[model samples]
Target chain A: MTDTTQAAPASTRDRLLDTAAELFYRDGIGVGVEVLCRAAGVSKRSMYQLFGSKDEVVAASLERRLPASEAFLLPPADDDRPPRARILHVFERLEVMTAEADFRGCPFVAAAVEVKSPEHPASLVARRAKNALTAFFQGEAERGGARDAALLARQLTVVFDGCGARAVVQAQPLDGLAVVTAAALLDGAGMRS
Target chain B: MTDTTQAAPASTRDRLLDTAAELFYRDGIGVGVEVLCRAAGVSKRSMYQLFGSKDEVVAASLERRLPASEAFLLPPADDDRPPRARILHVFERLEVMTAEADFRGCPFVAAAVEVKSPEHPASLVARRAKNALTAFFQGEAERGGARDAALLARQLTVVFDGCGARAVVQAQPLDGLAVVTAAALLDGAGMRS
Candidate 1:
């Protein structure tokens, strides 16, 4: 429980964002601003003051989540695990993520589909989430000494995103399957399997 | 354009299904029934009489599409191509599918995400679509003489779906990469690559 007195504007804003993120990720973006205000205990006036619009709230929520998602997909900093293993470790985190009761698929993929306009704020946030994963994969692939880091990164990201979709659509844990497939992918690419 | 005056009930019904499927697939299910009715040039009364609800319309659209989707993924009957090749042929079709300007990844995948409720009518439709793909893969795997046809089918499906998600998120083709990974998956499983 946060101290109400110490709760600043940032705290109020975070409460709103946290609620919005949960609703948006758990359910689709079909959720509305009125419902969002009700869920967050914030008035509509303050909601708009803080976040501008529902789209901004959506984008902000995704932006807030980007680092956490990146971290979960990232193995660790200063850890000497081989690059291929680090790359595969993303699935390990994925398994843990999908194991949660509230597990939903990739929020970015959902947002990308829901916010149809390519230049929409939420769309850009979703794109950032996706590109972050790709860049992470590229860093690890380069560390693992892949001859073509970009190609490897793109392929791994596909398997990663695919696993997310399968997990949600099938409503089951597919990270193990993804991990196995990723290994085969590494081996096929002449990386350490 | 459909001829409204001469349209029989069956033709009117098909017009709704055809237009709804086109709209639902091209855009997300965000397109409402009013828009669907408008596009199909049908009355809401007739639409309700034929399909029941928007959910039903979405489900029916997907159901109406099953045979055609199956046809594209299915290897040619009496296809003289190697079983492994038949198995990999799905990606070949996938490339063509994604190449369409209006392609929005897998409709079933989109439906699975967009429909929200797993027990929803459209949800079930999406599941059926996925299962059909799996069944197709299993058949090809068996025909290819795989030691474990089901295993190859599952693995290949992962890569197949991964490619689909990747293609949409990146707005680029990863079917080529998926084809390569599918080959490796087959090879690793002791199936012919």
Candidate 2:
């Protein structure tokens, strides 16, 4: 095998991306580019040369968070459960997340609140992420046989948003209460027994 | 009555409070004190004399928001209803708030997330505000005749948190959707028909 210890050119990009994600996710994109460059052990010129602008770097950082959110929202394939069960799994994941040390709430929601301009690319991505999750809930509600899937989806989306806020703001794990409550609603809707 | 146009000696204090609230609420507290002083038509020395530091000014500005929140959370005496109805009324008020032209997400939540330190007095106030809300839901759930009142209260709290985030982040109005959804949950818990 080649000596992997040598500094790699691509490693710089990775370092920059990782540092940007942490700072943006923790503080917000309003943090200056110079701070990010220093934290990443790169010069401003090199950072600009690689990422073009601060916005692009923030976009890249936000893109890193999507996969984790996707995993949180989706159910495990081996579970083999009804749509309601699958939907509830998302909350279970969130509960676990809230229990993690240094949990500061949903990064996407936090970022969405901080990024002022709706037209900003980072804001657009955050919005799309929320929309995608809402759409997924809508699909799940429909499959679960709600009379008004759209309404149910919207409601579930509200619960999801509330759970994240409670988890962070209250500094308490949401305790899977949102899922249990949502499941009860679905069952009452005649979607489940 | 005294001349209405005659400004009181303490009017400067009120002006600083008003300007800080407007700026801090519209933009985050990061906006410089000079800007706030200019907007309020007060001198920097006067601002310093009135509020010693920026943090003190920010705390005072946030304190001003508390009354509005209290009004929203606790409505007029003639508005008396059952616990479930009262809970729904809170969301109804929030719907109006979300539709306002300058609506932002919860100032407390925004401030809490930015401050990072849980020990900060402002952060403590933010936490207390959230806890107060949760306690309100719990009290309502218990009064509504739910067997598992605490569980139901926590669930409803999540719904409130979610609605607030969605209103600001997704630009969605918290209307009949949250009300209907939450009412359905309370109904399922046998709190309502």
Candidate 3:
């Protein structure tokens, strides 16, 4: 309570959300309000003013990462690659992400699993994020003329998540496992280039 | 420290680990030492005496669950099913487990993700547990005559984990996604019955 709140509301909000996302990903979701505020360099009062509670902050922060997550994981808007390549591109990116020393699997999955309560706001955001990935996969599957786009999409998503989990549990990069698994799914679905 | 260490040491350890598994699975690994001890009805002093640290408790609890985890997830002993059936049986079990209201994904995967530090004792135990699953898959793949047993085993593991992640994020049962994906992979690998 003693700390002064000098930063403007907008900047303060951005800073808090950024810090929240980073800390929550690095550590577990159990990080306390004091620790989060301290890491963000924001006062407790300012955090409360912007976010109703830490749970809201967790949800909002995950929401904020969605656009960037899709942008990077999904193919570029102007890219001319076929549906199959476009879909495989996502897994390729995942393989690269997993190679990083700090990689800890999909943040969305991590958050939802750690939150435990599926009804929690953060878990809701996580579900939405996961669904978006599935939607992307389904769209690609359809464009590629797969026999059953919906099933193919779900299959691809399962592979995506499974690869992420493997990386985390094995504490090793996927190398090309992501790409190979996705390719197998695409092949099985008869999703042509 | 005030609470007396009343129970015998062996029973006390069992009670503590059992409670730890239940609470940690229901909640997350972040459950504090005091809360865990209180739930187990063991004094803090007694818990410390038995387990060197909370981390050890987490690891040992997970280690204790391994036998049952394998027994349930793996095909039953003395079953005469073929390799494909044995492999699909695991996913069938996973589908059933995910249907439970209390399902929270694989405890080992959850623990590894929550711990963040791969070197953590709990993470190591989780890795060992996951590896056992992969080994079982590998054995079945070899028996079934997979084109490449190692790769097929890895793919199956990825699908298993991906389905688990899907269940946790969606907060809904997989509804056969697990079995279908594993079957697809088995087909792609050309693993004969």
Candidate 4:
């Protein structure tokens, strides 16, 4: 057995962001800054030195989440599925996420709801996440030859957002209800059911 | 004359709940009890005397919302309208709520997301709100003669929940996106298009 196989622990700043992500997403931003610092095993001075303010930390936590979220909506690189089929696949991914023990609905939505200012840095990030998803839907709808790309995009976005909301509010795990609804909506749009 | 004609002020307990409902819905439940008491103009001791705890205040706040929320989903008591049109009318009610200057997303959904515990009194209210909506959908689906009323209830719930989430998160006032989707879904289920 190797005696010195361990890698270095996460850096102080990384540790703080990781902890902040979990706390803010799990418990909302009402958690006091002091409580967060202590939970992260970080000194207040170090946290300030690294992130400037608690609001910035909230923004940074969501920023760190961007990559995984983008991946969730992005169709697989290797699959050659039709655009509409690929779009519907996002729900399957949502089901897997909802089934996780840590499923807390959409962090961006939670962040936006907790903040008062639309101008808040975190609110901007949250808004951007949703807007980007609508763009994804529009692009997919266009690829699928929809009669009205914008309409399809908004409908898809509503259903996707609804699934997250219903999942968390009802405190039920994912159930593919949104997927079924989306398929029916697509059929009515003249796409193959 | 004005002084003598003035009605008695609201009870301190009612004041506290009124304030709590406004604050908890406008902001998340992350608002401190001190802030709530200040806004309510009730001393902390008096607030505790009435509601016993902040969590109970939150629970009571959602409970206060029940009648209004139910009215939004309920069909007209004496009207003989078709089931699907009646169901889609809920979105029209939602649009009115969304247009209110003080409108936030569903209060129960907001409450559920902020608190960590599913067992939290507020979370129970949220789950109950969602369950009640699902039942409304199932009843409507059955009346509409859908082959699978339960499935329609769940799918409709998903779309309805999505609309609220999308509204608050995107900071857009409610539009008819959910209604249009619901109409198409109903048509697919054998309701007239």
Best by the DockQ measure: 3
The residue pairs in collision within model 4 are A162-B162
lDDT of each: 0.79, 0.76, 0.93, 0.79
* Cα distance off (Å), candidate 4, residue B121: 1.0
Clashes of each: 0, 3, 0, 1
Off by over 4 Å in 1: A1-7, B1-7
**Candidate 2 accuracy as TM-score:** 0.87
Which candidate, 2 or 4, would have the higher DockQ against the true structure? 4
Give the clashing pairs for model 1: none
In the range A1-193, model 3's lDDT, one tens digit per residue, is 3235544667889999999999999997899999999999999998998889889999999999899989989999998899999999999999988999999889999999999999999999999998899999999898889989999999999999999999999999998999999999898899868
Candidate 2 lDDT over B1-193, as tens digits, reads 3654456646888888888878877777667888999999999998888777887887777777787787876556686787878888877777777777777677777766655445656667777787777788788888889878888777877777777778777765665666777787788888982
lDDT of 4 by residue, B1-193 (tens): 6654543233676788888988888777878899999998989997777676899999998888888788776677885787787788777777777666666677787788777667899889888988888898788889889878888777777777777777777677767787877777787787661
Best by lDDT: 3
How far out, in Å, is residue B113 in model 3? Answer: 0.4
Best by TM-score: 3
Model 2, range A1-193, lDDT digits (tens) per residue? 2545445656888899889989876666668888998999988988888776788888778877798779766786576787888778787787788787777777777776666545567777777888888888788788888888888777777787778777777777766676787787787677772
Off by over 4 Å in 3: A1-7, B1-7
For model 3, the local distance difference test gives 0.93
**Sort order, DockQ high to low:** 3, 4, 2, 1
Residue by residue across A67-86, what tens digits does model 1's lDDT show? Answer: 88887778779768888888
